[model samples]
Target: MIFESSHCPEDSRVETQFCQNLVAQANVDRAITPERSTSISPDSIRPKPSQAIQQIILFTPSRASNPQIQAALVKLQNQVAAELRSRGFTVQSVPTGLDSASAIAWINRRATPNTFALSLQTDAFLNPDARGTAAFFRAGDPQRQQQAEELVKRILRNVPTLVDRGARPDTETAFGRLPFVRQLSVPAIVLSVGFSTSPQDRNILLTRSSAIAQGIANGLAPRPVQARSTTQVPIRIRLNGELSENQGFILGGNAYLPIALLNGLAINFQRPKTAQLFT
Candidate 1:
């Protein structure tokens, strides 16, 4: 965010030139930044349950060398992808014995407006003593960034025993951005499920793999609307924080919305030419 209070010229004279110079300097600084990434807005294609989410890519990125590491990573990847598929998600994984880059490349080439990617990794780079989960998302694209954070929160709920490291900014200046997340063409989240070197963290991965995968699935899944019961509470409705006449007082709490809003319901009136109507 630009701070106009500090930077704006006190005198209005030659303000345009001052503003132009500031913009030029900002552009130059941006050019020198190595972490810069191209961004796209997905306004037309935010994933919806029936139409938006067509394919999900489950990827474990490293090209492991050790025999044990390679076999174990592949098994984890397969099982997680399997769990997502079982939840009725269309999931694709790197076929047995193939390099991760190939699978990632395939995903990039075939990425549709309606797909999302899940990049799974064991966070061994973090200190061995540090334990818990973290999720990462590229900067920009608020909807995509939010999806990443919400999924992280959902993962936390399922894996309650583990410490919550929370979500990390992929574009933070201290840690240069993650390349895979930066380049991936779809909305993506990088999940560090646990630390491999930490024994307890390792145990969580070994024991709760399915539950974690299921949590991720639930985060992305279209929530089922509860059948409206006799119980109801009236509330003034707001859409995206703004209230409109189209939005009237409805039966629900702001903490959670009713199914009528989720799937959409309309109150309609039919009038005859001569009729004077009362609501």
Candidate 2:
């Protein structure tokens, strides 16, 4: 999120405090979960336990000393820290120089598994003083890396264009062209709060990470894969009833399977509902 201010000094302070609070939340969430145990019969085999999902939060701010931005940034950061700590996340907030290359380099230093970094401008989106700003994620199966990429791509396609005298100009100057780089492995979705000028209203832009999560759960999107030869295969589908030359077969892709008949020979191959590109 990019925040615009009249003076740089007025906004630098908010950014610094925001970074500090995120660091504190990261430390608190790292504490170990309490253990509990129950014994099974000696003859019974032990069951494998499910592991917790780990996520890291990274924040990048261009100017760190501005007073107006710093106050807002720090208060917002502290609120974020408290919320994330209540949930389970290791949040690391880092304040760095405005140079895009250097800020990215600073982020690289704190990289971890399932890390999500948020780079925002000072005072980008000012939420109402009462509501406070927040991005909510619906907890479910962890979203895969490929699904995240596709959603992110769709989001980039949707970014509002900035126009200058009928000519489009770059809106994000500090992080010029950084969003397109795809080297980072873990999927990241950015939630930004900023001002919108169509009707001169305050708006929140949700990058749809949760919607991506749902699409992935339903297996509507394909996972990322390496390049491979486009080999075609002949598919021979079988139906239960006998076929006659005079009887024309109508194929319908949308059908719900009966759960009770699944255990029988009525249904065999498990296939996704989406249309297949290859036949």
Best by lDDT: 1
How many pairs of residues collide in model 1? 0
Q: Model 2 RMSD to the real structure?
A: 19.5
Q: Per-residue lDDT of 1-279 in model 1, one digit per residue for the tens? A: 011112222223465356546656545555796444343323223333323776888777553433444455556678767766776778877455445457656777877777788777665422357567777766655666677778777877888877686776555422234545656667777777766656777677777776777677766774578775534444567777976344333233323344355455463434459843222
CA RMSD per model (angstroms): 18.4, 19.5
**Residues 1-279 of candidate 2: C-alpha lDDT, one tens digit per residue:** 432121111234675356445435433433342111111223321212213335544453543443444444444444554445445567666654445555555555666654655443323322322111212111121343333344334333333231111111111212211231222333333333222212121222233223323322222122346665444332333347732222222233333333333544466666668744221
Model 2 lDDT vs. the true structure?
Answer: 0.34
Q: How many residue pairs of model 2 clash at the backbone?
A: 15
Error of 1 at 168 (Å): 1.6
Model 1 worst lDDT window (10 residues): 1-10
The prediction achieving the highest TM-score against the true structure is 1
